[model samples]
Target chain A: METQIDKLEQNKKSKEKKTQPEKEELKGTFAAVLIVGGIILVGWLGVFGLFLERA
Target chain B: MHLHRYEKIWLMLGAGGLALFIVLLCVNAFAMGMAPPSNMEMIDPEKVMETPPFDKPGLKQVGDKEYDAYMTAFAFGFSPTKMEVPAGSTINFHVTSPDVVHGFQIPETNINFMVLPGHISSATHTFDKPGEYLILCNEYCGAGHQVMATTIIVK
Candidate 1:
């Protein structure tokens, strides 16, 4: 019985390990998206401001 | 080709970004009437000095609040170096280079273009604010390229 329980726990741990890297990758991608979006937004605002100031 | 789900998502996002950029550019060009310089008119570079408009390079009042500014770009200077126009006046600039390629740019406005020999570049801008706008040549012409500048005084 003890050996069976250990085997089941090991299987669960392995499954979790397989998904951990994917979760980290998704987080990194989300961060990259947010950073890019922020930069674009700032650039657009700066251009619009310049146009209004000069034009 | 087999693509991972993340890769497919990234591909779609990149395509969408490109499409958005192109659409915005088109709208700004067509709908907003913001376009780059075009060489619709042509002229003889040698005879540019004798051309009707180029022959008279100065500000001429055309209408109630409209003016036609005929300008010539040379080796290291521009004709009609100093000009004064009324505020809230629409000025049409017809520029040409008589010697070599040059640049025509008016700081603090959307008036920037290249002056190519044998080709005429035109742009229109209204001076709504009363200020001094400096015109500078961005292209390298010769030794005196640094001094190739003029000013437009809006009163």
Candidate 2:
């Protein structure tokens, strides 16, 4: 009975290890997307400032 | 804060669209003769080849029987606000801008170039036909861009 339980625990650990890299990759992709969005926002704001003279 | 997957995608798209809009506006302005900041100094197109005379009382002359003139364009003003070139004489134009990229053109003569800040652009023309040549800033520089047009007389 002890060996059976041990086998189940090992299987679960292996599954987690296999999935860990995918999770990290998703996080990295999300970060890249955020950075690009931020850059675009700043560029637009700068152009708008040029036309902001009060009449 | 935690954003849902769809929300994140939409946010990024919105930001990208804003950037594209700004870029397009600038491009449109330039195509419409609105001047923008440049990397060169602005010189009046009329000042080239003509030098004020030390012996004469008023403005000097750089050439024989030719008077000095200037055609300056800027975000707000153009120097030598007025000019009259003699008919049948080669008039050298020294065109430049003070703050941005201004275009100098005499549509009748087909003269055009970018007036970069901190740089001098020279163009020469001999008016064979006597008439009024319109000077229009072909670059969309700012608010007054539409009314930035002026005139040059070639008699």
Candidate 3:
């Protein structure tokens, strides 16, 4: 019974280890998307401002 | 795939931003009447001289405080190079090219468009301020492209 409990604990630890890199990858992707979104918003606002001035 | 809580939130926000951009563009174009040049009017490049309105290229009073300016662009020169219109008058510019492609751009106003050989491009603007607006051919047509300019005297 002790050996079975030890196996279960090891399985849970391995599962967490596999998910560690996945979480990091997701974080990187989210940061990249936010940066791109911010750039697009700023560029669009600049263009709209120019349009208003010219029009 | 199972998305994390933060990832799902970010995705929704990104989609919402994109939607907002599209809506703004639509409102500006349709509601505000801002648009690019359209190819609605066509003419024969070789017979541009024989055309009715272009044959007599000049400004004509169409209504009270409104005028129509018919213009033709050819090989580094515009016909009726000097134009005069009353201040606070709305002028509808009808422009076409005979020889090659050129650009009709009046500085300090929203009067800029491509003058194609067989297409009649047009734009309308009201000159509220009485000033001389320089009309320049923004497109490079030939050697004399530098001097391809005129003046619109708004008085």
Tens-place lDDT per residue, model 2, B61-95, is 56764554445567765665666666766665655
Where is model 2 more than 4 Å wrong at Cα?
A1-55, B1-60, B65-68
Candidate 2 A-chain TM?
0.49
**What is the i-RMS of every prediction?**
3.7, 12.1, 3.2
lDDT for model 3, on a 0 to 1 scale?
Answer: 0.87
Q: In model 1, what is the error at residue B123, expressed in angstroms?
A: 1.6
DockQ for all models: 0.17, 0.03, 0.33
> Candidate 2 chain B, which ten residues in sequence have the lowest lDDT sum?
B51-60
Q: Model 1 over residues B42-141: C-alpha lDDT tens digits?
A: 9999999998989989999999889999999998899998999888999999999989999999988878899999999999989999989899999999
Which candidate order results from sorting by TM-score in descending order? Answer: 3, 1, 2
Candidate 3 C-alpha lDDT tens digits along B83-107: 8888899988899998999999987
Stretches > 4 Å off in candidate 3? A1-22, A25-36
Docking class of 1: incorrect
TM-score of chain A of 1: 0.54
- Which candidate model has the greater lDDT, 1 or 2? 1
> Quick one: best DockQ, which candidate?
3
Candidate 1, Cα interface RMSD = 3.7
What is the DockQ score, from 0 to 1, of model 2? 0.03
